[model samples]
Target: MGIKSWLSKPLASWIVQKQKKWSSDPVGTQKNVFDLLIKKAQKTTFGKDHAFDSIQSHADYCRLVPVREYEGFKEYIELVKQGTQDVLWPGIPLYFAKTSGTTSGVKYIPITKDSIGYHINGAKDALLNYVHQTGKSEFLDKKLIFLSGSPIMEKKNGIYIGRLSGIVNHHVPGYLRGNQLPSFETNCVDDWESKLEKIVDETIDQDMSLISGIPPWVQMYFDRIEERTHKKIKDVFPSFSLLVYGGVNFSPYKRKLIESIGKEIDTVETYPASEGFIAFQDIPGQAGLLLLLNSGIFYEFIPVEEYGSANPTRLTIGEVKTDVNYALVMSTNAGLFAYSIGDTVKFVSTAPYRIVVTGRVKHFISAFGEHVIGEEVEQAMKNALLKHPEVSITEFTVAPQVTPEEGLPYHEWLIEFISMPADMDQFAHDLDQEMIQKNIYYKDLIVGNILRPLVITSISAGGFINGMKKMGKLGGQNKAPRLSNDRSFATIILTA
Candidate 1:
């Protein structure tokens, strides 16, 4: 390896050592980190003599700060839009990471230099830990094809700004950055569609060993590659060895993706948001491990059972356990204290703090009072798909809607199928049967006839996910709503 590449390995190794030192001693590490953050916050204008004096003081301050959803940050976002430096933090934020949440309209999350370091280091630690766990160093040498958002940096008042996409584009090592394909200019608004086309065309023949992005977009790229090359992606990119994806559960699309790839590729699931890179797959066979940014933020978990209710118990990293689902809350370096992002996760293990995302706290159908969660729906769908080989779902969504006849509410399914079952009515019946069998709550509701029969709306190939993407609703950490209980979604499904 050349000097730069050789140096990167050592640097990456150092990051791993540093992270292990922090993660292993969660309480002690957080206390020290929190003390330092409190000092910094106190020095800042917004934090000057403001309630918190120490780490515990900071946590207490956060608890009293009144948890704000993404919408609460809109005023700060407007400051960003104006290129003003009057919000939280010292210097002007380096860039804004474009994202949207359930309650938050399109947002531009600020990423300061310090915040960027936390994200980059978290990602580095994840990579190095993967190497340490799997004993595989080949990935470090391979060409990684990250199917990221557009790298275009928008300029405001002579200062370049955008989302994490822009920051990452500008901040990567010069040598590797130089090796990357030409980035799409963010300043040019009209080039967005063309940029995606360019990314597809440039990597069609390359030895792309590692692919990373939202599953839908990654699949879209593969579909584009197939259409352009007139060959299956497996044939075109025969050297593809790993698929690293985040932003949505791959379980629903796993079987189809695996079959399409024609070989088992090492898969890594990441829980990265525009806010920060929260967790990533550490060991080869394990799901994602939560590598908490102990230094950058105070993490809190509200038990899933208490979700949407007032005063759920808050859990620190040291207090979490395996298999219990919790809604994630974070108090970050960039002045967000005790903020709820509304995502839910389940710990796979607590010894090393591994987590598997359960689903969104807000994204569920509850018309029959069954409290159906995203994970439950995904699991039910998986079983249904597995049992009926004749019915291959390309895309689907679930929602609770009130029928016009009696105005009684029920769950509706909008599904796109690659192949229809010979007996359509039996297929629908089996779908309900599998859901009832796998999910007890759903079964109880169905048995009582409180929930209506499974309503299936056939859509075209790649319709649901693609349509969502076209509507500017796709990103790394956001998935098309699997369960939308609102009238807007109901109207769309009915009209479509």
Candidate 2:
């Protein structure tokens, strides 16, 4: 924590008070928030009255909006580039948060002055709340290390630009910025191979106290560091206090990462995006609290259910139930109204609205007419890993593919490990058994022999995510598809 962070307790209280006033009201709060956004959106040339309508008018407005993906927003981004004031918000936007989605190559998401301030202040509030909940003051004095994307601004026509990278490069507090190590931008490495090398070199001598980033990148950094130093990260950053990360599920990699760190570092998950910072871990022991940026955006949830079901129920903050998954829809300060992010989340509680991200709505495997969700796969995998004491899985990937001769669909598990059972057949059988016990659908499918179980051991040190990173598709909001129902990439991996 920095000096500003220490002084932000009052600011945190102010934000909380405002949040309480808004969140507690529920119905009136949402209407007010939506109305405010509508007033703002009405000013934009692209905005229409239908775009700003309520959740009940979703069907009517959705067609008008036409589900504009990030690519559709590229024109608005170009308008920003021209330094025009005709884009989503008033005046020139501060910076763009670069994020990649399924089809969008690289989305330069506009972050207005107000949006940036909201994110910065929200971050402060979250930190201060963490301090209050944990009953620890050590964080206030320790140096924080944010494992983020390099703050390299791209020069176009002699003007430096690059939305997200520029924001982090320019907006970080000056004092803390000076103490930070080299970013991916500082190093002359544009490709993953050299970038990982640079990351290893920069942190070798730093007195890092906290680490934060996407889980896969963190794993990659530690793996590279270990290879170079012949010591785990615990040996390198002995004073490390916390591991804060989000952007993907951490449960699968938690055990290994904990072991590598050697000491029990406090773990915190943040549900942030290029669009906005939606939620953060408020209390230390409690699950993450969905601190709705009430002033920043309006939110709605659609109950997740099987296909061919009745109309999905739209939920307000008050209506959300614990332990049930919901598809999130948002209308943000930045022009995206009634936007579906394609992610799924389950509420741990409703009063404070704490949620644990269940999985991706797009990343489900439904072979043999059985819908196997990402959470189910993750839970089953975790359970299977717990059964073996000697085996340690560092990373893994699952792809649904059809067997060559039989033309039958099956799941191919690509597992990377430190050690494994010498009898490969027995290991496979045990893993299959564990999966069966964990997920009934998978069990029934296996029992019916519609999907044959298979596992491939990768000898490569960095594992599947590293392979994806090498292809320039890792970090930020982009993640390696954990459950690929499509057989395109699966067939290649299975054959290889």
Provide the overall lDDT of each model, using Cα atoms, as 2-decimal numbers: 0.67, 0.66
TM-score to true structure, per model: 0.88, 0.84
lDDT (Cα, tens digit) per residue for candidate 1, span 1-496 = 4454455666667766776777687777766666666666664444553455443654576555555677766766676567666455565676767766556667667677777877776655666665565555454454566656555667775346655654565555554554454343421233334555777767776766667777766776676776788886678777677787777888777766766677778877777766777888877676666657574776778897886566668777778887788988876776655667788988887666778888888887766667778887787778777777766666678876666467445677778776777777777787777677757887887777777667676777657655665656544334577886565654554454
Error of 2 at 416 (Å): 1.4
Q: After superposition, how far is residue 210 of candidate 2 from its true place, in Å?
A: 1.0
Give one digit per residue, the lDDT tens place, for model 2 in 265-363.
Answer: 787777776677778887775766565646487776777773223444566666778888788777777767656677788888667667888877777
Best by lDDT: 1
Checking candidate 1 for backbone clashes, the offending pairs are: 96-162, 96-163, 97-163, 97-164, 152-186
Clashes of 2: 2
Candidate 2's C-alpha runs over 4 A off are: 1-23, 49-87, 155-166, 183-189, 306-313, 406-408, 422-427, 433-444, 454-459, 474-478, 489-496
Candidate 1 Cα misplacement greater than 4 A, ranges: 1-15, 43-50, 54-59, 75-86, 139-142, 157-160, 182-193, 308-310, 404-409, 437-440, 474-478, 493-496
